[model samples]
Target chain A: MNRKTLHVVFNSLFGIGGFCNAILFPIVLETQPDSLAQLLKAPVNFLRQRLWWLWPASFLLAALAKFADKKICDRWGHDAVKEMLEILREKGFPGNKEPVHFHRVTLFKHKRWWLCWRFWPWSGWLVPVVRSGHTTLNHQTCFLAPDEADHAEGIAGRCWSTKAVILIPTEDSNMTLPLLNPEVNAKPHDPHAMAEIYAKETFMDTDWVLKKLPHSRSFLGIPVVVQGQPWGVIVVDSRATKIQCAKGILASYEEIARPFIKCLERLS
Target chain B: MTTAPWIQVEPSLRMRSEPRQGLQLTLFVPPHEVPQAVRGEFDKQLKKFVIEIRYLDDEDFKRETMDDTVCLRIGKNSRRLLGIELDTANLNVAQVQFQLKEVEEEIKRAVTKFLQKDQAQEERENYALAIKAIESKGEQLLNRSILAPAL
Candidate 1:
């Protein structure tokens, strides 16, 4: 049967079962009283006497199930994201004209309980790096690759929270490969603008990159901080016409990145 | 159109034009050079086309020193090339020549396809505003599909 129908049937069965156990079963226990019956009846009477107890137990069981599901999902999601990273590295940053690398991965915890439980019950992730840092860290380090460094700087200034999460999108295999690369090309039509846009909206000025290039058609760069400290980054590269990085894909990546950052935090 | 120096050799390609996202183009090249007649014939048959290109290298390309290597970007999404990877280790004259020809062909075909993609016209306007929004603030709207609650 269809999903909706199945849900309706299952829920109906549960409601009926619960009602029978709560109401009818007690009545049956009261009416059928034999020596053997009282033995079976004794437990039912005890439960009936404490009718309110069933309510809390049911609620607790449902809560436990949900908690269990979340834990499982988190573990699986973490493994999946890690596997994806490995695959991207193994593929050698496909499609990009430049070479790219991943420096570090991080996970962040959502402070608001409701928000955390609703979206990320565990935590968030981020990858931070010095996009254009040379031998010694200098403000002029910003000038070498003005566009990328500027963007990286922007992220560093505002979104510098050690607790914030970074998300990456892996569903679109096409975008995933390039996003994982460290180096990218600049085409007039590249999605640097879109990446910049996403960064601006999602991260604070301290935590995102804010630069653009004329020739860069598409580019990939990772955050440069983990748990509030400056870390490395991940990168992607590609050169297909008509490519645009969507907001949805990046958000998905963030989901996985959060937990990863948490794991890193624990290790450190 | 016929008089234009650049010819439309293949069908056009189109894509969503987001400022943060860009188009990618890949081209296939022959291993060896052919006669002028062959080049002319090939151009006539398939001079333009479009393909989705993702940038993979964001760091290495930025630090690339060799002009022959064409280190275009420094992001994780960067890859070597679309169809066939050039053997950079060998550094043979013939290989370089072949790769150069391929790059040129890819660019031409990509540009033609880009122009044909009419959606870019509108997207460019939207992306411009998005850039402005980002300039005002550091964050932009991220896709919700993949977003889960932060831990």
Candidate 2:
């Protein structure tokens, strides 16, 4: 069968499984009486007496199941993203012509809810799908390390709690990558304007460089748009301070974005 | 609270002249951020669009909330479209609130789209303006050269 059909089937099964595990199973287990004799003893009285345990039990099971569901989805999504990155690497990072080599291609997944905490709003995280760059320093400082447990909590404390991904939803536009060199690009608040033009593409300039990784000069990112919504960003950063932007770079970024968006669409 | 069963009514079927709450926006257009003339024109255009734009569920439910008010026609022809009545009788408070949020998102999206469209429009106009300015300056320079040689 084709990839699209396979994707639809996978989604159907995932949804059904999620419903059964998170809703149906918990409710079925929790609502069942411990003893039939108790119900027989008093049908109306049984609800009043047994409901206390059943409510909490149902909630607990449902919560656990929901957590499991999110974890499963995250794992599946990470794999799909990783495969796309590998494909991008194989293609030699298209549109990326001389002096603008992709030192590293990073994907930052935006977790709308922090650890499934609905009330906490949005948080962005770099998943361990693929990485290519200077091995030690770049890996350590650029992306979130696998063992970085307190990062989310640390983000919560800062005033700049908003992730770079947040810019995508706000400003939505498209343009060629190289057209935005500092010399010719005279637009004030270029970051904000870039957010719109390359609404899909995220650019990490000086401020972001200073804050996140001083090693990387500029980062070009594109949103992985799945089903008309942005799922995450595919970022390509250069270790050099200035990089040439050209038509080939735009074409390459677009090519990478298209497949990345498609893979995420399958997950959606 | 009167528990009268609320029936969904088509917004178009309701009286257009009925007193309803209008969508109010407080835009902060910083000085020199946008030319006053452009900002003024944008404000007027945006207000017109908001009023003219149909309600969020207008297509599906035949509703038209004038000026971004979440007014719903609960009953048939002989219905009231007043704000208090809309909240108490016509609309489901919870559902309307939720729909209002969706409407807000749509409006924000619309604003972004509009700004982009407007920016493109301004760019074209600016391009034309630049050509006109250059042409006029070139003509003056030519005229000066002709006058200088004659003198």
Residue-by-residue lDDT tens digits, candidate 2, A164-217 = 211111112222233334444466455545444332223233344323322333
True contacts kept of each: 0.00, 0.00
lDDT of 1 by residue, A47-145 (tens): 566756665565554455445444443344445445544443334333444433222212221221212121232232232212221122122211111
Docking class of 1: incorrect
Q: Which model scores highest in TM-score?
A: 2
Residue lDDT tens for model 2, B11-128: 2222122222212111111110111010000112112211111111111122334324233321122111111112122222342223433333343343334335446334222223
Residue A157 of candidate 1: its Cα lDDT? 23
* lDDT of each candidate versus the true structure: 0.30, 0.34
Candidate 2, B146: how far from true, in Å?
60
